[model samples]
Target chain A: MTSPLEQKKIRITGPSVVTANRTWDGAVVYRTAKQGWSTELADSAIVSTSDDARALLAEATADDVGAVGPYIAPVELKDGGKVKPGNLREHIRAKGVTIDLQVPA
Target chain B: MYAYDELDRTLINERVSEFRDQVKRRLSGELTEDEFKILRLQNGVYLQLHAYMFRVAIPYGTLSSKQLRRLAHVARRYDRGYGHFTTRQNIQFNWIKLAELPDALADLAEVGIHAMQTSGNNMRNVTSDQWAGVAPGEIEDPRIWSEIIRQHTTLHPEFSFLPRKFKIAITAAEHDRAAIKIHDIGLRLHKNADGETGFEVLVGGGLGRTPFIAKTIKPFVSGRDILSYIEAILRVYNQYGRRDNIYKARIKILVHELGIEKFAKEVDEEWKAMGDVGLTLDHTAIEEVRSRFSYPAYEKLPHMPDELKQAAHDKLFERWRKNSVSAHKVQGYSIVTLSLKPVGGPPGDASAEQMDAVADLADKYSFGEIRVGHEQNLALPHVAKRDLPVLFKALDRLGLATPNVNLVTDIIACPGLDYCSLANARSIPIAQELTRRFANHDTADLIGRLHINISGCINACGHHHVGHIGILGVEKNGEEFYQITIGGRADENAQLGTLIGPAVPYAEVADVIEDIVEAYLALRDRPEELFVDTVKRLGVEPIRERVYATR
Candidate 1:
C-alpha cells in the first residue's frame, strides 16, 4: 500500500528568477512575473499531493484563472527552503497568495 | 561532560516553549493527528502501546548530578517512579500522558535537559565512548566531537526530514567502546602521518533489519572539515536515498544499493560542492568547544591501594574484577561499570531512589560525572581503586551490584510488546526467565562474554542482531514465541547473528538457552574460546542439536 505521501504528486509553477545564488530548484528567493518584486519565504509555504493541489486549484478557479500557477513538487523544497510537508499551504496563505494545483500527477 | 553554554540553554528553552505551544495546539484539536505525530516525534514524545514514552537525551552519555536528580524527580513525579536507560545512552520515562508532556519538558528544562531530536527522522543524541575523557587507550576525548556534531545537527534545517532516523557515534579509544562501526556515521580519531589529528570516517553503517559495519569513505578526513564532510554525506543521502520503502530508507541501504565505491564518489562530489567556507571547524570555535571538555585535573595518587589489593585477593573482589571493573587511564583509579542487569529484573531499569543514589555516587566518587553505556549500564569513570569496596557496598544496597557485566544474565532486552507499540511480542518476561534460569553467577560467567539481546520488534533497539546469542520475540497465533540466533556481536568485530532453528514457547526459552550453553561447554576447544569465537568456528549446529534434540 502506498503511504499518504507516496500516492500524491505536487507540481509548483511560478515566475522564474535567474541569479547565480537563486538558480537552484528549491531556492526560496525568486522573482515574480509582476516586475520588480521578489518573493521569499518568511512565514509560510505550500505542499500539495495531487489531491491537495486539485482541491486548492478548484477553490481558486473563480479567481483569476490564469493566476493559477504551475505546480512544483513539494518534495523539491528539500533543496533548502522554509517549505515543508506540514506547513506549505499556511506558507502560501501567509504570503497573501493561494496555490493552483492539479490532481493525479 | 559537554557543558551547556548560553546558546545551548537558550536553544533548549526555546524548544520547550515551541513544544509547549505545539502540545497545546495538538490538545485543542488545532492540529490533526498526523500533524501532531510529527511534531511530537520531533520533540522525543512517542505514543507507545500502554502509554506515552518520552526519551530524554543524555548527551554523549554524560550527565550531571543535578540533571540526574531532576530525572529522578521527573520519574517520581510524572512517571511510575522509574526510568529505563536506553542503548543510545538516553533515559526513557514510560507512562507520560499527552497532556503532561509539556509540563515534563518544562521540568526537564529547569535543570538543563531536553529531549529534542531524540526521536524523528533526524540526527539522534550523538553517542560516544561513555568513558570518553578517562578511558586509558583513548588518545583524545570523543565527546568534544560528539558535542560539535550534536550542536551542528540539532534541528538542523537541512536534516529535519531525513528518509529515516540517523545515528552517529564516535570513539577515541582503540577498543571501540562506543560501537562506532555500526552507526550511520562512525568517526575513529587518530593522529595522521604528518602528526596532525584527523579521523577515519565510516559511512552507511547501521544495525536493524540490514546490519552493516560502516565502510571507510575517507581514510583520513582532517579534523577541521568534520562538520562539512558530514553535511556533504547527508546531502548525498537526502538527494538520492530510497524513500519509497520505509525498510530501505536508511543510508545503509543506499550504500549497499549504490555500492560503497559509488557512494564514496557521491559523498566526494557533495563534499566538493559544500566547501570549507561556512562549514569547517574554525580554530577559535573548536577551542571554545574543546575547552568545555578538557581533561579533569588528576592529583598524583598511590599506585594500587592496599585495601583494593587485599580485596582483589579475596573472592568477592575477584568476582567484581571479572565483572564490574574496566581498564582505567589513571594508575590508582578505574572505570567502574555499574551493571543494571540484575538477576530477574529489567535490563536497564533503576528505581527513582537508585537513580538518586547513582547521582550521589557520581557526585562523591566520580567528580560529579556519570556515563551511561550503550549496553544499558552506568559507569563511574573515575572511581578510585581504594573505594571499590565502599562503592560495591553502596551499589549492592541499591541492587545494582549484579556481577554479570557482559555475561549471559546481563541481557539486553527492549521494553518489547509490553510498552512499545511496534513490538510483536513481550521481551521482558523472556529476559526475566533467562535470568532466573541462570541465577548462579559462576554458571553465568562460565559462559563468558555472552551478549544475549532480545528485541520484541525488528527495529532492534535492543541490539539483538549483534548479540552473541540473540533472541527475537515474535507473535504467532496471538501468543508470544522467541526465536534464537547465534554468533552475533557488537564491538570492534561486529557480526549479525544467524537464527538457530524453530521458535520456542516463551516458557521454555530459558531452558533452551541453558541447553545451548551446556552444548557449548561440551564442545569447546578450551575454556578460553569465547562464545562468539566458538559459535563462529562451529556454526549453530551444536547449539541447535542440544536445544532441540530432546524437545
Candidate 2:
C-alpha cells in the first residue's frame, strides 16, 4: 500500500520541483540543480514528467540535509527562466508574507 | 503586573539556555526534525509556511511600558518590524529565524517575559479579565490568582506532558471579560453569601474540533485551596485523559466521557490524597503579588473633566469615546481599548513603530502600563478622563484609532493558511474583506456588539466557537469553503454558535453575513435588542432561511 503522502500526490502534468522549508530558518526552498537547497526558485531542478518528479521528490526526501517535508509542487517557468509557484499558497510562501511587508519608519 | 523574583528570572534564563543548546543540537543534525519539533513547540517556536513563528506570553495580558518597548525593539530588529497580537493575549512574531530565537528570548527575559508554556501540550498562559483590577463591578483582583496559577503551572514536573494542551482563565468581574467558561479550567472569583472571596471552578471547557462549555466541578473552592484543587483536577486528567486519539485528548473529552459528577468525585479523591502538599498559598506571598499590582497614583479629580466634556461634543472624539472608552472603578479614570482592527488591515497586526508609540501613549496617558485584551486589542487600563481627546488624536495619527470596538468591523482572525501549516484556508483576507465591506461606521454602529471571529481550522485559535458570528474555514475537494455560525457569544452567557447553512464559497461570506444581519434587523423586537439576544429569541431558522433562500 502506498503511504498517505504518496497517495495525496497529484498526477504531474507540467514541470515540477521538490520544495520544502529549510530546516534552519523555515524559509521556502527548492531542491536545486546541484542536489542542494536553493532559496531562488529559478535554480530549482525542474522535472518534466511524473516519473522524474517522483524520483526528484524521493531524492529530496532521502537527502534530508537541508529541508523538511519535501514534496513535488508544480511550477511555471517564465521566459526569463523565472519560476513561479502554481498555487496561491506557494506563491504567498515564496513572497514570505501575505500582507504588505513594509513597516512605517 | 507581578514582577518576577530571583527564582522566576533564574528559571527563565535556565530554560532559554537549555533551549539554545537544543537548537544547536538540532541544527548540527544531532536531533531529527520530529525530535526538534517538540522542543521548539514547548518554547513557543513554530515552523510555519514562510518562516519560524515565535510566540511570547504576556502574563495575564499585563505589560509595562519598558516591556512594550522591548517587544517593539525585538520586532524592529529580529522580525519584519511587526507583531501580531493573538486572541489568547499573546504576541506572535511571524518572521522569526530559528537561529536568532535564542537571542530574541534573551532580550525578552530582560523585561521579565518568556514564551514558556505558550505552546506545547502543557498548561499555556494563564489569562484573566483585561480590566481585572480596574473594572467597576469586580469582586476581587483576578490577576492575583492568575499570577499564583502562572507560578504554580510554569514547568510543573508532573503535568508537563499532559494528554493535550490545556488553558486556564480567571475572571473576578460581574461581566465575564476573560471568557472563563471556555477554558480548560475557568476560575470565577466571586464573593459568597458569607462575604468571603472564593472561586467557582469550571473544568473541561475547550474549543477545537470539539467545543464545550466548561462544567462546574467545584462551585466554591476557597482562595487558599485553589491551587491544590487545580492540582487535583490536573491529576485526574493526567491519569484518565485519552492519549490514543489526538482529537479526544483534551480534558474536556475526559470530563465528557466520565461525566462531570464522576470527574468531580475523582478530583475530590485526588485532593484528599494530596493533603495540601505545598500547594496552599502563604499570606506573605499572596500579599507580595498583590503589592506588585497596586493602584497607580491617581489624582483627586472630579467625576468629569472639563476637557472630556468639551471633547464629548466633538463628533469624531465622541464616536471614538463611545466605542473605545469603558467605565473604570476610579471615577476620574477610564479603560481605553485601542482598536488594532484598522480598515483593510489584518485584525491585530501592529508595526514596531506603532508598538513604540502605544508604549509612549501608555506612559503619557496611563501609568506606563499596557494591557492585551482577549478581543485582540490593546488597552490603556488607567487613562485619566482628562487625556481622552489628546490620546484619541495621537492614536488617530498612528492609524490605530478605528472607532469600531465590539462592532462588525472589529474582527478577530487567526493567521490561517497564510502562515499556519495546519490551516486549510486563509482567514486574514476574509477578515480584511469583512472589515472593508463594513467600513461604514453608521452601519457598524447600527449592528452593535457583533464579534466576527474567523479561524483557519478547527484548532479555533481565533476563538471562532465563542464568536457572536463565527466563520470556520474548511477545504472541500481542494477548494476553500467557509462555514458560518451565528448566535454564539463569549460573555457571561457563553454558548457555541449554531451553523447557519451549508458551507459557502469564500467570495460569498460577506454577503451571507450581510444577509444574516438583515434577517436580524427584520426580526428584532427593537434596535436595542442585541444581535445575539435577537437570535436567541428568534431561532437560527429565520437567518438560515434567508441565507439559503436562493439555493
Candidate 3:
C-alpha cells in the first residue's frame, strides 16, 4: 500500500523520454542528443535503458537556463515508427487544450 | 473602490523592479530554477503544463473601469487575447511568458493592480460580496473590512510563512454571497439591537483534498475590536498549527484537532494576553479609511423606469432581466450580472475585447465600477434602472447576455486538464455540453437557482464541494470519469454535497445532470423549492434511484 507520491517516485517502465518547458516562454520541450531541447515530440531522443534515461533527465534538469522541471516520461511507440505520449494528460500537453476556445469579440 | 496612495504606488513599483531583476537573474543562469520558482510564485507566476500562468488579485472583487481596461491591455499584450476569472475573484492569464511577466505586472501596476499573495503560503486575496456597497440590506460594506485586513496582512512578517495557504472572506449581507464559511477566516457584518455594527467571526473552513464548513468561533466582535480579534486568531493558529505534515497543515486541521471550544478558548486567551495592541478600529479610523473610498454620486430617481417596463415586453429581455438583474440599495439602480457562461463557451473567460467592452459599459452605465464574483461572473454593481434595456442590448451584441445567473446553465468549471497541471480530467467540455443541453432560456429559467460546479480534481478550485450539483472529475483505468454529488450549497446553510453513486464516463455527464434535474422537477414540493432544498427534504436516495434507473 504505497501513497500516490511514493508511487510516483518509482521508475516508470518501457521506453521513456525527458520532457520539460522552455524557461523563457514556457513552451513544452523534450530533451534530445547533445543536450538540446525541442518543441516537437518527434525530435525527442527516446531511451529504453534506465541509465540512459537517468543521464538524459539529469542533463536536462541541470540546464535550468534552457528548461525547467525535466523528467523522464513513458512514451508509446505506434505502428510505422510513430511515437506519442502514453497518456491523455501528456497528449494534451504535447498538443494543446482539448476544446475550441471561445474567441472573444 | 480604494485609490492607491503614493506609498502604495512606490512599494509596488519597487516590487516590479525587484521582480524584473529576479527574472533577469534566472534567465542569465545566475539563479537556479528551485531558487526562482518561489520568487516567481511571489509575483503570481506559475509553471503550468503548457506554459507559465499568471494570476492577478482583484481585492474583494472590486475593479474600477480604469483597472479593468488595463487588464484588457495585459490580455492582448502578454497573453492570448483573453483572461480567465477564477472562483477566488481573481483573473488568471494562462499563457504568459516568464520573461514578459515583469512588464505585464508593471503595466497592471500603473493602475494599482498586482499579483502579490495570489499564490504561496500567505494570506490570499480577501474576498467579499460583489454586491457589497449597493446591496439593499447589508449591515455595512464588507469591502471596508476586507480592505483593512488586506492592509494588515499584506506582507505581515508573522503570517508570511504560515503552515499552509490561508484564505479569508467577508460578507456584509445576510444572503452570504461571499461564501464566507468556506474560508480560513470568515467575517459576517452583523447589527446589534442598539444599531451598532460588529462582525460574526468564523474560522477554519476550506475545500481541497478535504472540505469543512467553517464554524462560528465568536458570535460577535465589536467594530472597535474586530482587527484585534482577527490578530488573536491568526496568532493562535500560527502558534499551534501543524507543521510536521504538509497534508495536514491548514488552520482547519488545527481547529478540528483542537476542537472549536478549545480553539476558541486559546484564541480568547491570546486576545486577553495581547492587552492593548494599538490597531484599534475606532470610528475616526473607520471614517478615515471610508473617506478614501469615493462612492458614486447617485441621483434620486423613481423606481423601475418606463424604459425598463417597455423592455420587459420583449421575451428575451424579460428573461435576461429576471435572471441577471437584482435590486440595488439605491432606489433607481439595479445590480446587473453579465454572464460569462455563454452556451458552448468556456466558463469565466473574457477576451481582451470583451474586457474592454465591459469597461466601456461600466463607465457608461455603472459609475465606472465592476466586480468579479466568486461564481465566475462579472457584475456592474450600480446600473440605472432606465439603462437596463440599453445594457442588455450591448451585452447581447457582445455574446455575454446569457440570461442564466443562478440557473443550471450558469456552470462554474475550472480549466481542467485542458490547462491545469494538477487536473485529473477535463471540466470545460462537460460544462459546455450541459449548457448546450439547457441553452433554451425557458428550460433554464424553469430549473432556476441550481448551481453546477465542476472541478478537475479533488482540489475543488471550482467549488464542487459546495455546489447544488457537484461534479468531481477522476481518472480510472486511464480514462476520464466524474463523480456527481447532490445537496451541497454555499450560503449561511453551507454543506458539502453527498456523493450520489458511482463514477460516470465523460460522454454521460450531461445526461446525468439531466436525470438529476428531471428527478428534482418530478419530486420537488413546489416550484419555489430549490434543487438543494428538494434534496434536503428528500434524501439523495430518490434522486440516485431515478438517475441510475435510467441506466
Candidate 4:
C-alpha cells in the first residue's frame, strides 16, 4: 500500500492550495497567482477543484529552483479570504512548532 | 571517548568538502531532487516539516567536553539555539538550512564528529550502555567492543545497501540498560563456564509495524571472532532479506519467516566459510584501540564523604540523589543521570546554553566526558561522591536536575507530526501532557519505574513497543487517536506489548493512562509490585476493564 505522500492523488473536497518547501532554505512555501513562491499561506492561490489543484501544483513544481515537493494541501478558507489549515500539520507548518522550544536565556 | 587519528580527521574533512560541491551542484540543477535526496540523507540531512533536520552522531552516546562545546556552538551558529537528543543516542537540530548544512558538518568535523551513514539505510551509530565503564559488576566496558564494531561497520562496502536499515546495540552489564534485545543485532558480552568473555549474539529483534523480541542465535562467540561472526550474519541477510516490500524489508521479518533455527543454520554455514584474516580482534589490536581513550585520574576517598553526609540532611538533595544517582564500580563515586525530561518540557531537548553548562559541569564534577542515555537523558559517568551536592545544585539551577529517571514522567517520545513529516500525530504534546499529569516527583517515586514510550506513528521511532506502557498515535477520521499497549518491556527478557481495547481520542489519552495507573495501584499486591509485573500477573483484561470502566 502506498503512503499518502507516495500516492500523491489529489482530492480537493474543499478549498486547497499548492504548497512546497523552499529549495535552498527548506522553509514551507505556497504558490502565488503571480507565478512565484511566498512564505505566507495567505498569498497562496486557492483552488477548489481537483483539476485546478493538479494544474496549480504542476505550475508550482516547475519552479524547481524556488520550490521542492509541490503538492496540493487542503485548507479551510476563512473570513476575509483568509485560509486556516484544514489539519494540525499545516497549521504548525504555516506558523511554527506548536510547543514552545526551550531556548536558554 | 576514542581519540581520532589523522585518517579519521582527513576522511571527515574530505567529506565536508565533497558535500559542499554536491550542494552547489544541487543548487545549479546538476543533481535532481531524486538524486540529491539520497546524498543528503547519507549525510543525515532530512527534510522535516518546517525545515531541513540535521542529525549528528554521538557515537555510542559518548562525547568529550570539547565536542559538547562544539555542538553548543553549532546549535547557536548554524541552526536553532537548541537540539533534540534522540533515543538512538544522537542529537538532532530541528531547524537547519540546506545551503548551510555543509558548513555545519565542517564545524562538526574539526572535533572528529561526522553524520556519515546516520540517516541512510546503512550502519547507524553503534549504541551501548551509557554507564559502560562506571557500572559495577559488568563483564567489561562495552564501549571498547562498541568502538571496535564502529570501526568495522563505518561505511562498510557490502552492508551499506542492505534490504533495510540495521541497528546494533551492546551491553556488558547484567542490568541491560542499553535495551539490546530491541535492536536489529544485539550483542551482550558475557563470560562462559571457562571464564572467557564472549558475545551472546541475538538477531532479528525490531519494532515498528511489526515488533519482535530478538532470539539468541549464538550463546557465545569469542571476542577475537566477533566481527567475523557479525559479518557472517549480514552476508546471509543480504542474500535472503526481502526488499520487495518496504514493510517486510527488515531482517527481523526474514528471521521470523525463515525461523530462528533456519536463520542460525545459514549464519553458521557462512561463518564456517568466511575466513578470519584481519577481522580477528587480537590482544594487540584491542590494546591499540584502548590506548586511544584516556581514563579519568580517580582519587581515593571514603564511599560516603563528609560533604555528602552533611548534604543528606537536605530533603530536596536526598530526593534528587536517590532517583538520579546510581552506584559506580569505583569507590567514593557515582554515575549521575541528568534528566532531559523536565516536566511540561519537550523530552530530550536541551538549549545551547544548557549544553555549554553541562560541558562546564562535566569538566567540574565528573571527568571531562559525558554520555547520552538511550532513554533521552545525559549521564555524568564518573562524578565524585563528595561533589554530588554541588553538582546537584548546579544542575538544579540549569533546570536539568529532574528527579524522575526511569519514572513515568521520564517519557520517551518521537518528534512526531510537529517535526517529522511521516508522523500521524504530535508525540511531544502527548508526552508533555502525560509528564504534567505526573508532575509531583514524590508521587512519581511512589509509583516507581513505569516507562511510557510514545510514538507519533507505527514507525516506532520512540521504541513504544518496548515501553512498560506504549502509546501509538494513528489518524482516525482526520483526527489523532492513540492506541495503548500494556506489559511491554526492554530488558534481559524483552517482549512486545499487547494492545488493549480500541484507540482513544487525543483528549482522552492522558486520562486513560491515569486510569490504567490507578488500576495498577489498586490491583497490585504490594507497593513494590511494578505496573508491568501487575499486568503480567492479572493480564491486560483487568487493566482494560478498569480503564474502560467509566466509558
Across B426-487, the per-residue lDDT of candidate 4 in tens digits comes to 89999999999999987898899999999999999999998999999999878899999999
Compared with the true structure, the alpha-carbon lDDT of candidate 3 equals 0.90
What tens-digit string does per-residue lDDT give for candidate 1 at B1-551? 66678887898899988988887776565665566678888988876533568999998899887888899989888887888899999999876766777788889998889998999999999999888988887878888888889989998988999999999999988888788888999999998989888899998888777888889999899888999999989999999988899899999999999999999999998889776558888899888999887455666768777877778766876797768888788888889998888776877887888888899998888887788999999988888778888888788788878899988888888987656656766687788778888989888877887889999867788888888888887767546688889898888787788898899977778888888888888888999899889999998887788778888
Predicted structure 1: clash tally? 9
DockQ: the better of candidates 1 and 2: 2
Q: Estimated TM-score per prediction?
A: 0.83, 0.95, 0.98, 0.98
The residue pairs found clashing in candidate 4 are none
Model 2: per-residue Cα lDDT over B503-523, one tens digit each: 998889888888888888888
TM value for model 4: 0.98
Model 3 residue runs over 4 Å out of place are A1-8
Score chain B of each candidate by TM-score.
0.97, 0.99, 0.99, 0.99
lDDT by residue (B1-551, candidate 3, tens digit) is: 89878988998899899999999999999999999988888788888889999999999999999999999999999999999999999999999999899999999999999998899888999999999899998888888888888888888888788888899999998899999999999999998778889989999899988899999999888988998998899999889888898778999999999999999999999999999989788788887777778789999988968898788779888888888999999999999999999999999999999999999999999999999999999999989999999899999999889989999988999998898877889999999999999988888878879999999998899899999999999989889999999999989899999999999999999999998999999999889999999999999999999999868
Give the winner by DockQ.
3
Question: Alpha-carbon interface RMSD of model 1?
Answer: 22.2
Please tell me what DockQ candidate 4 reaches: 0.55
Q: Which stretches of candidate 2 lie over 4 Å from their true place?
A: A1-16, A47-55, A62-65, A74-84, A101-105
